[model samples]
Target: MAHFDASRMLSFDLETTSADPMEARIVTSALVSIDGAQTDMLEMLADPGIEIPEEAARIHGITTEKARAEGQPHDEVLAETVRRIKKAWEEGFALVVYNAPFDLTVLRQLTGSFTVTGPVYDPYTVDNIKDRYRKGRRTLTDVSKHYGVTLDNAHEATSDAIAAARIAWKQVNKVYPDLKAMSTDELMEFQAVGYYDNQENRRKYFESRGRDGSSVNTSWPMQD
Candidate 1:
């Protein structure tokens, strides 16, 4: 986590429809810039192109009717989101997603649905959630509580994004003492091990997700 300079990073979070990326809907997104101390927020009520299950709305608070009224066309929003993400990457910033796998998976699905073509952003390229585990917390809420970071309107894109950045800062600074001394790759590896709750539980999660635990080899990762 400390291997990379915080100034070169961007923390991002997404509020989506479901846990399954292939079937998820990215309702809103946000990014926090570490370099300039600025935050960029992009939120929308996404037209899921299907019914919004009541269970899903309970989590994100975006209903199907609300989305249909205020949300941008699905294809247009997808392209813009992809373009902005790429633009940020080109500017020498790596995206820091909480659950990189989930967010990136949903991003990939959204792009495909829109028929947008190009390389999808690999979230592992900039995940800090793994690093936060050094403190013995796993879920975002626990990390937030441990670090005194308020979710700020919770479920909202910008607030969650900002919270992710704050959590990363607190966790990384604890390990390296100097945020400027670490390499990006080193930081990522540190985060991977740091965030693991326990070797056994971690392995179980991967096995359940159908992941080989090296790289994500299957979409389901594992079955419940």
Candidate 2:
């Protein structure tokens, strides 16, 4: 039962062309590593080989014109992103993702072989479980503000990745220190189970209201 080393972490985030991971095309991607005082980031932008929607461009500030001029080849960026994520997992670093399912599922769909065998630390899931009764929305922005983690550039991949890592690090070490003592596998199960239960409860609530609860798949850390 290896324990999660909160002192060291690797996080991934992506700014894309759409909201749905299934339909999104990567516009920017980041793999950030945080160890003690040192932080390193591998950030990349892709041309996406398609038009960037106005809404998405507004969110991430990656215009179609800008991406086409400066971004790398779509295939190259996608493959390299997956390669580095797998490599980081091989190096015993827990993957820190704000919303694990969105970015990871995008990578999974984009690179067919995008998969991991190591522990994953999803702050989004952790925050939802840890503060299940919190009133406001649990978006990255909301959680960042609630935790007092700075998110100056809300939609950028690198900034979002770093913010997520800091938020989780703080949560485990400061807010809910008991989580720091859980085994690596235990931590994974905690998020997995918590997310599943939360989603199931939400589904029941929606169903009770006579709404379609099936739209939101209850799969944790992945869409399907």
Candidate 3:
């Protein structure tokens, strides 16, 4: 049997036209659900209806020309995605997001009806909570490396989703075994508190370096 804290976990990710989630337009999104050997992946490309800046396109490799040519309408993609995620959450799967705030905020902005339906877990947030003094960059690539999860495709939505799930699995089964015993809601709350404290700690760290960190979002799963 799979050793995930729950029998099922749903992980999703997105590549968008901007870094600020509130202003971003989705270019690609992926949902990956895993229950033991069975994995279901839904990947969508959306025509963002705006210019995809060169810097953003370079990150996820979804150029404006390609999106305009091959992607589906933004509404169609977001609607289907919302349905899929809601159904999964209703079925009792924990949601895994790498950096939950950014992706969730983007979804919230684009789909007005997309409120997160179930307890959400953020691998990045918990990692910060559990590994506070570890000195390294906390990007998905860096954390996946520390957790020994394979992240061969760095910025791709589908690959990132899978990696997030794997890292969470590692945490549950081995790295942070105590986390498995907590209820999803409890675990989520733990992350929320940890996220807040971590943000404050970061502000202190930055100020110590003669810089300001007050502009960063301290929200847990979503920015607004």
Show how many residue pairs clash in every candidate, following the order shown.
12, 0, 0
lDDT of 2 by residue, 104-156 (tens): 88988987767758889998899899989989898889899999999878998
Q: Predictions ranked by lDDT, top down?
A: 2, 3, 1
Ranking by TM-score: 2, 3, 1
Best candidate, TM-score: 2
Query: Where does candidate 1 have its weakest 10-residue lDDT segment?
Result: 116-125
lDDT of 1 by residue, 31-99 (tens): 566676655556554676677778878877888888888877766666667677677666767666666
lDDT, candidate 3, 69-105, per-residue tens: 9999988988887787898888778888999999989
- In model 1, the Cα lDDT at residue 101 comes to 58
Compared with the true structure, the alpha-carbon lDDT of candidate 3 equals 0.86
In model 1, the Cα lDDT at residue 67 comes to 80
Which of candidates 2 and 3 is the stronger one according to TM-score? 2
